[model samples]
Target: MKQWWIIICMILSPCLKADNLFIEAESFDKKGGWVLDNQSMGQMGSPYLLAHGMGVPVENASTLLQVREAGEYRVWVRTRDWVKQWDKPGSPGRFEVLLNGKALRTTFGTEKAVWHWQDGGTVLLKVGENSLELHDLTGFEGRCDAVFLTSSLDLLPPDGGNELADFRRKMSGLPAEPEEAGEYDLVVVGGGMAGCCAALSAARLGCKVALIQNRPVLGGNNSSEVRVGLSGLIASQPYPNLGNLLDEFGVVGHWNDWEAKQDPSSARSKQIREILQRHPEKKIHNAGPATNYEDEKKQSLLQGQENLSLFLNMQVYDLRKEGDRITFVIGKSIISGKEYIFRGRLFADCTGDGEVGFLAGADYRVGRESKDETGEPRAPLKADRLVMGTSVQWYAEDAPDRSGFPDCPWAIRFTEETCVPATRGDWDWEAGLDRDQITEIEYIRDHALRAVYGNWAFLKNQSSKKEQFAGKKLAWVAYIGGKRESRRLLGDIVLREQDLLENISYEDATFTTTWGVDLHYPKPIAGMDEEPFLSYCDVQEIKPYAVPYRCLYSRNVGNLFMAGRNISVTHVALGTVRVMRTGGMMGEVVGMAASLCKKFDTYPRGIYEMYLPALQTLMRQGVGKPGFPDADKLD
Candidate 1:
């Protein structure tokens, strides 16, 4: 990468004095050069007060205005006492100022009586037109009565100037030397629920296990980042014993048809609600719902486990092996920019994206298998051209007492489509506000939030039931994208949709995923009105399918195993396994099989033959019914 720096200077005519151009605001309630960004109201599609008017304190209120002429200047202001309930120590009541949108160090600590303007803050005014801003960091408690500007520019080194430069310098430095990852009996990549369970299960067996998680936080889609609730089988038939371990670990919550109580009842609210109501006992939370994996560490949930070592924010960069004997692996950290080298006897590819298998030179499939490849009825004659796109979500709240629309940053198309009134059962998935291109995904998500707020404004101001939308508001915008599908790894056994619906039970079955066979098509391609194409196979439901251990291991890389949606399956088969519970179970099995391999000092494939009894023992300990119960139950 290259760097560039450029600066422009404008000279002012002598007749134009520095004193002529200055804008000031005494309050924010009425046209004081302030606007409420009502795009997100708290997931409720409504508007609320933006600044001092809303319940939010005014001490940290931000104000921006233009000044036509520039000169060295002294800026001062008075502020009332900040409300202590929301203020913390060392926090100035009238905090921070900005020049030309860049923040300046300006503050009035809460020490004296009301409205006392202090002195001694100045900045060098560049020789042209400039913008001056005063930000109310504490919440603008006292009124901002007036402004003072002078020709004396005292330019001190800007705050955060070196801090930012240091950050950039650090980012450019070479990453740390890779850690020496010793020969792990079993190495599991990806740290979602399944991967976590797998790591713990193997470690508990006295096997030295290394768990690699690409993300800082685990739980996969069910994690707080993606926010997709878990749903799928709790126990494979006759395997209630297999489901016991997950049940003990809060995995039983996804079986419900109703939404988790913590879920927001916005556009897709009904769908979530329906799921939760249908399955009342599933474990779920709405807010602070374990979105961060570091939270798990604080709780000490996995502490004191001798066998497992969970590495966060680390990604598999490469894998080295010959024939079936895998030797070592390479990993890189996303944050500290560190790399690691791990030598493991057996590895599991739970990265969901199949990063492990792919790096190990495994044969993988990126799209749907042709009908000729699977012989499944619903298989397309050829691969479909489009793939599912990812989505980000937002939240909003309604205005109090059905007020007029707030000055939110709503797009033109949003205001046109968001004129509806709020009613019970009014939210719809189809009510979003943009096209379906990947480049425009964020555009749609933002507009969707804006549309929700705008419609709520209409409800509060003009709709027949304005009274009903009085207090709803948008609260949050999910920090991460909710992805649906991506690359998949080819394994020793390729699972077809026909095998699922036909209920083919493999002798080497490790777990079963019961989410209904489902598939989503990209919105109709341009110039075509009907769906681009749909097969009878795509249109129908398939029965629960048993996943064999073989499908989780690589065809090319012997020591690598895969879990989650990236397993060897046609696109149609992935629709079922993509759900949270199934992914979790897959991780659990992979971990246990890895442990079994470590105990035998062999690879994952060896577990099926030489360590079948121990694998059975692990299955009996995990979720799903223990297959071949008479053979060997894991102690």
Candidate 2:
């Protein structure tokens, strides 16, 4: 009799009354054409589901919700009007909510620039499973963070920022303290080519490593999400064997157009054809195939190492510091609401934003430094907010039949005078150099999107070449913004342009940088009313210079190390070292330094001061696989 009573109670428990229910949009089982976007979490407070319709309305996003009571519940949704910044009359990101196959009276995603609650009148929910759906009304970009249903008439949705963050944690029933992920000798934040090499190099040397990336994929810029072809020469001059690991892990074949045309006269073309013949599964086309991003290949390589652990979709938000050292970092999954605490003796800040260094209170700089500050002639006479712009590359496909694109009124308008008569958006298509790349990332990305959509609309509908583009359809546009520069974490030595021009050698030199000082600016094109999306670049070649080990670690933070574009360099010097391949070599050197830290039981500064000779010996011997022909060589 007691067992029967307990079973009955267990079945009846869900039917009991409750005050409220919270549903995170990202946690929905069936996303259906919606993208999980966590890029604005720092500013908006939580990851949201984005219906990034490029002028065509996407399918509805539905989720199953269990109600505790069958009664009238007030509905509230968190969203924003993305185009509100333009002070536009109509909201581009408008959507509707449906409950149990019935459309609600209120329309969502019409709020202003800030994230807020949009009231959806009373709804009748049953005391069982109910279908909750998000219907995009416009073919722009509609976003939904979370939905809240409450019985109390006075209860309102949580406001944005820290309050919203705390409310999310409470609503999600996440633990108050972060769960211990694991202990490691080294923890690397950022999963770009640099971070991957750093973690792999350290792990191969028998150090336990934890590589945490905010995105679902491993590579950052090089990943399929961004699709930037690797540039700059690796395994050259000063350190011949330093970048051998890069060839082992990097994507094979250059993005040269000749390779796609199969021109036997070009050496690269013949080599690519031979490679494809050997491995038919690998495709080599223009800018290489989408597979060249190699998401699985990177994951497989990291998983093969027993000492290394890869954590994807984990965004590090906070860190615990003991004096000058970082003890552990706090990360939260973009998919799930679970929080993680990763403890390590050493930490590498490969995040291009320099997030770890910023959190640890390490000194850093943003934008361009004046000529007086670094004595670089190319720098501005007076310091101002001007840095290399971010890129949003895109491509189009030829359709057998003519295709039409909708007119995007909300996007930046382009006239025939300003129409770019091209089907591909390469490195030149860039913007947002004057804005804050870290805090204003969403705005920058949105601006790029507007540029692409607006320009394509003009070409297809209004431009003189409309007939030419009629048969072409928009194929792919990178949603992940390819950032060129951000916060430069200060180190013991800040590399300057003079170092590369004079070919100065340091005792702690590890890798060689062959790329010239390449900087970007928004140059005016004839007949354009406003600034063009395409950027103008200026390059000055210098002798192959060795990068110092002193520029790899933080000066103030004892256990902190950094690589990639965030390394210590002047705005002028960063022009050369910011290339992906050069950054990958920097990562290898940092990885070696991390292994040395473990062996000597010391910090980054200690490795430079006390054990300089040992590091030189390791650099001389090299850590990467030998005998693999150097794929990228300088003239």
lDDT on C-alpha atoms for all candidate structures: 0.52, 0.82
- Residue pairs with backbone atoms closer than 3 Å in model 2 (clashes): none
Highest-scoring model, TM-score: 2
Per-model TM-score on C-alpha atoms: 0.61, 0.92
Which tens-of-lDDT digit does each residue in 470-561 have in candidate 2? Answer: 99987777777889998999999999988888888888887889889999987666775544567889999987788999999999999999
Query: Taking the tens digit of each residue's C-alpha lDDT, what string does model 1 give over 1-635?
Result: 11111100111232223542222342222333223321221121112122332213343334343344555677654333332322333322344456667665655534443334445377666655565555554232223433445443331211133432232223224333557867788888877666766676667667788888766566665565555556665556534344444433333233333422323554234543554454443333322233322234411344546867778767676667777556888875544335688888777777665667766778887656778878877678986534443444333444454334443222212232335443321112121121332233323333333334434445555555555655654333343445555668887788878788888888788777777677665332234232221111233565656688788777777777777778888877877887766776777777777766666777766777678777777677663323222111111
Clashes of 2: 0
- Runs in model 2 with CA error above 4 Å? 1-17, 250-289, 525-532, 627-635
What does the lDDT read for residue 516 in candidate 2? 93
TM-score of 1: 0.61
